[model samples]
Target: MKHIAHFFLFVALQILLMDSLVLYSTGFCFIYVAFLLFLPLGISRVWLLVLGFIVGFTVDIFYDTMGIHAAASVLLAFLRPLVLNLLTPRDGYDSGDAVNIHTMGWRWFLAYTFTLVIVHHTAVFFLETISFQTALYTMVKILLSTLFTALVMVILQLLFFSSKRERMDYR
Candidate 1:
């Protein structure tokens, strides 16, 4: 139920709002990726890939970009678990753990988001460009957009999500 609402919210936000926002004509914020990034930690990889495709396809429909978003998003989904493993804490994630700032701590969340965002943006820009003619420009766009998207995601998480208190299981 909550995921459904987030799907619509992120798609609408990306298409209606973030689509038009371009900073310095280089930085474009694709806040829609936040939907995929913040999914519950215990979700299956297949579901993550499916959801990533669905969200990216929805955005591609609006943007008319011929599936670039979908490809990049699928790549992001594929890379997510690897990133999570690399960043896993000493005790590892609890079953109910989430990928938000509140649950994962700011450092972990930032590292996770930034790493994924850069990979996603690289795929997006490079696939869209399909040439080395503007390699530098594309790299700039990837970095700047990654920064912009990560910043917006962090701010949104901070503003909207409350800390998740530990749950006690009483037999």
Candidate 2:
């Protein structure tokens, strides 16, 4: 239920605001990929792919770019577990541990977010470009956009999300 709410919230933010965010008319940040990053760790792969598609498709509808967003998002979702496996802590995670920065700590979350966002942005820009004629341009756009998106995602998490333990620390 909470995931559903977040899905909609991200979709709305992407379609309503982020779509119009054009840096230098070439670099564009797609912050919606953060939605896929923060999904509960134990969710089934099938549902993750489906939800990724739904979020991307919804954003595509508004952005008017057809299925590029859908493709990138699905790829990001598919690659998430692989990233987690590579970066998992030696002690492993508790079942209740989430993928958010507050749960995973800033260092782990930064690595996780950077890896996935690069993959996601690469897919989006390459697919959208679909030509080597401007490959250099596309690569530049992907790099800049990934940095911009990742920075925004980190700031948002730090500002809005308090870990269960942190909330308790307030008392």
Candidate 3:
């Protein structure tokens, strides 16, 4: 229930707000991937992929970018488990622990977020352009857009999802 709401919230924010921030004419910030990143660790991959497709399709409907967002999102979902395995701690991830800054810490969160965002942006830009004549331009777009999106995601986590100050009670 809660995640469903968040899914819609991120979709709304991405389409309504972040989609308008065109940087360098070839780059655009996409913060909606944050929703996919924050899904619970124990969710089945099938559900994850389905949810990714749905979310990406929803975003595509608003952004009018055909299936680009859906394809990128599906790729991200496919890669998520691999990324999580590569970055798993010595004890492994708890079922309830989300892949967010509060649970994973800053360093792990940044690496995870940056890698996934870069992969997503690379897929989106290259697929959307589909030509080697503009390979250099596409590369620039991927890098810059990945950086901007990562920065925004981190900032948002810091501002809205920080868990450091949560009040605890001692009886």
Candidate 4:
């Protein structure tokens, strides 16, 4: 519930400011899909889907893009646990800890976030494009946008969260 609220707040900010940001030619998409990546490790699968739907639906409402955000977000939510399973050791994750660079480590979090971001961006762009006539350009745009978004997710996580605090909480 707390996570969902934070995501909604950030999505609101993104909707209001998305027009002001750009990367090269592509726009910077700093959304709360990062929250999807950070869901508690022990959460139920049903809550996972529900939270993804909430965030994605909220983005859809703000951006007026229909189901694109919903599909991409749900996909990311579904993939997150798998990525964590692969990246973190069997006992590495805990339900109480936040999923940030500080808690998950930079390499693990980056790889996890990047993979999900690329997957999400690909689905979103292709859904919006709904065509592959210029597949190369579309691919480039998706890659670039994903890269920028991933950076934003990481930087935000690092800035907002620090390892020392997480260590105290875990202890």
Q: List the residue pairs that clash in candidate 4.
A: none
> Considering lDDT, which of the candidate structures 2 and 4 is the better prediction for this target?
2
Whichever of 1 and 4 has more TM-score, that candidate is 1
TM-score of every model versus the real structure: 0.95, 0.92, 0.92, 0.88
Candidate 4 lDDT tens digits, 28-139: 6756677777666776777888888888888888779998998988988888778777887656766566676776677877888888899998888899889999789889
Which candidate's lDDT is highest? Answer: 1
Superposition error at 121 for model 3 (Å): 0.6
* Candidate 4 residue 82 C-alpha distance from true site, Å: 1.2
Candidate number that wins on TM-score, 2 or 4: 2
Q: Model 3: number of clashes?
A: 0
* Model 1 per-residue lDDT at 145: 99
- The list of candidate 3 runs beyond 4 A from truth reads 164-171
Residue 103's lDDT in candidate 4 = 60
What C-alpha lDDT do the candidate models reach, one value each?
0.90, 0.83, 0.85, 0.77
lDDT at residue 38 of model 4 (Cα atoms): 63
| Residue ranges of candidate 2 with Cα displaced over 4 Å | 165-171
